[model samples]
Target: MKRPSLVLCCALLGIVPTACGPGSDPDPGVDRGDSSTVDLEHLAITVSGRAAVFPEAARLLEAQGQPVPSLDGVVLTVEEPLRVGVSDADSVLGQGGIGADGGFSVSEVPVRDIHLSLAASLQQEGFVRSSTIIFDTAFTRTRPHTDIIDARAWALPNAFHDALTRSIGDASIRAHSGERASTLRDAGFILGRVVDAAGAPVAGARVVLDRDDLAGRVYYPAPDFQSATQDGTSATGLFVYVHSGTAAETFSLSIEGTQAYLPRNAGATPGLGLVLTLYPGNVSP
Candidate 1:
């Protein structure tokens, strides 16, 4: 049997699917133009972290009893204004070489910009990088200093190539229609992880949005990449959702279609990290 289209699923459930038509602009709230420039202090700081192979690929290999790939040759560049994990601006802070064990550090780096500090994955030909962690800087009074980054990338594994092909297909369609590629960068984003009672990442569990209007605004990593499954959560348990408008949004979350989990009445906001824990379905949240 054929699977349902994501747009159709949302529409059937009373959620407005963004851009349901071919080359349609689903979200009007996304800022199509450049963000306003704000003058801020540039503080030089140290940034360091591990650049591991995408956990999903690793899991796929390990499950099949294959040797996992090494982190030896991947190069990571620190770029300013993390444009949804990929950078377009010319501003770059520094670059670090990954060790065999996926560990690296950059010292005396100048500027602690929001996107730059996340250790933007640079050119590693034939590899697609997943979104890295976004850390808060000194500008915010709450937990300033982001000196560490943990990131993952896929090395053209068959499964990843399949997903990439879907993404390229979507981009090709938009390009053919003369519409700029949609990355949802203008929309506010919420980054999160889902885990079970054992504190282990729940690979296949889906995070269902409670509100009807939030449909079609969420993506696994970003709008450009297509997830391998309709669950919209990656094998490593990361998920993201875009806000419908310019304002920050707080949305309720629940686990769908699984009797194994009883989700809490959790809430998440854009521009921050959220972790949702699931109790046993037989247990109370």
Candidate 2:
């Protein structure tokens, strides 16, 4: 089947465009761009616990396999700005909402001086309370995927955008805390379907995204943190494309249907022509 495209792990990082088509589809959701310079993007950040109760709550929630964003009730200040930082820019890419999933999305962001914060409003019968969390302003240095400019890259911007959005539950967890960085693991191109020597796509074959470490600093934009999918794939054997935040000097970057992940933090960027491919989908498997 001639599908559109899918970028499972697409985040907004400023860099030169390696291969951007002119007639690319317009951002489907909210438009966060101005007249100056802007690009529709997603801000994916890792929201960890800051206090004893918080982290414990997070772990408890995780154990139940509940979505982090759904923790708004347990944690206070769900409807406020708590995230702040000097992110790697890509964490705050695109604008608008694409409701392919239950969560809404938005793309088209102003390239200059980007910030993702949250605010809370209280309207209850007893002990009313309100607070807001503000994220640090992350400036865009350039467009993402510059080195791969020459690679025949194709992205399903909407799907990429959806996967990039954080649930309201995720926002609540990240709003109250300090910054905890995850090591940027070695990332590679994630194929939608397993292919044979003849490059024939394989269905139900399992094409996974893996890496070595988790050295990347997590950042959350306005809406939520990041997201995941345990659901099975379509009959076509396709999953979302994920970009590894990890970086490598001599690596095999897959140059096909995919999205780029920064193995590091929200705004960190490597040199141009950056990518690698790992066979069998494991570094030490």
Candidate 3:
């Protein structure tokens, strides 16, 4: 079957998928053009935590009964005026290197919210660098004197956002109370199914969920966070996308090969699931 054009999906969702193309700024809410101009007190932001491999990558390993990847040696960078998503090359505010103990600290940071980007190189000889993981939550100063930022990157299925938020919250509380914060680990899931006009399962359909605010930043399931699906849909036309966070946020859904589907676009919540139905009809090319 011919794959449905993504352009159509974008149109149906009332979103321009390419609005945030390279070199284009999609976030008008905040000005992140330059971090040097921001006049803020320089505060120490100490980050300590484990940096695990991408959830999706770890899922692949677990499926094959392979040992889970380590969280050590991950390089995390903090950026100011948080962007919609992480880029390969972005201006850095501070950086920390995760050690064998899964702890690293960056000091002398401006008192403000920051975007944290986590990246690491794989030990495999063939596959070297891993994709950078950015959380939806921004790390902000919880207290005036508190600079210690406690965090953790775990291999939890569909819980990165939740874990990060919890960690940040705990760190903020600790900073206020002048105590050390503990690590965080939480997860959430998104279940979905694609069916045809006659209510029959439509296997091999591609479904994607992305933040409405971040035009180009797409979220996927664990073990394959980069790809919505490693293989096509299941025999039952069911697919589940996981994330490490809460489901209070709204998201836009896009279905591939939707030309055969009647109502392709559906509303989605982070932890909640969605169902898309296809009808036997001729769609425009």
Candidate 3 lands at a TM-score of: 0.33
Clashes of each: 2, 76, 15
- lDDT per residue as tens, model 2, 1-285: 121111211223223342243334222111222212222343221111111112222443466575333212322222211121212334333322212222222223222332222212222222112221112111122222111101111111222222332321233222221212111111211223233333343333323222222211122222122433434223333333322333311111221233321121121122111111112321101
Task: Name the top lDDT candidate.
Answer: 1
- For every model shown, what is its TM-score relative to the native structure? 0.46, 0.21, 0.33
Give the runs in model 3 whose Cα sits over 4 Å from its true position.
1-40, 80-90, 111-148, 154-285
Ranking by lDDT: 1, 3, 2
> How far in Å is the alpha carbon of 142 misplaced in model 2?
29
Choose 1 or 3, whichever is better by lDDT: 1
lDDT of 3 by residue, 35-54 (tens): 22212244333434355654
Tens digits of per-residue lDDT for model 1 on 178-278?
Answer: 34333322222344566665556666667776666664444454233543334466655666554432333333456677756533332222222222233
Question: Each model's C-alpha lDDT?
Answer: 0.42, 0.23, 0.36
Q: Which parts of model 2 have CA positions greater than 4 angstroms off?
A: 1-151, 158-160, 163-193, 197-200, 207-234, 240-285
Lowest lDDT 10-mer window, candidate 3? 135-144
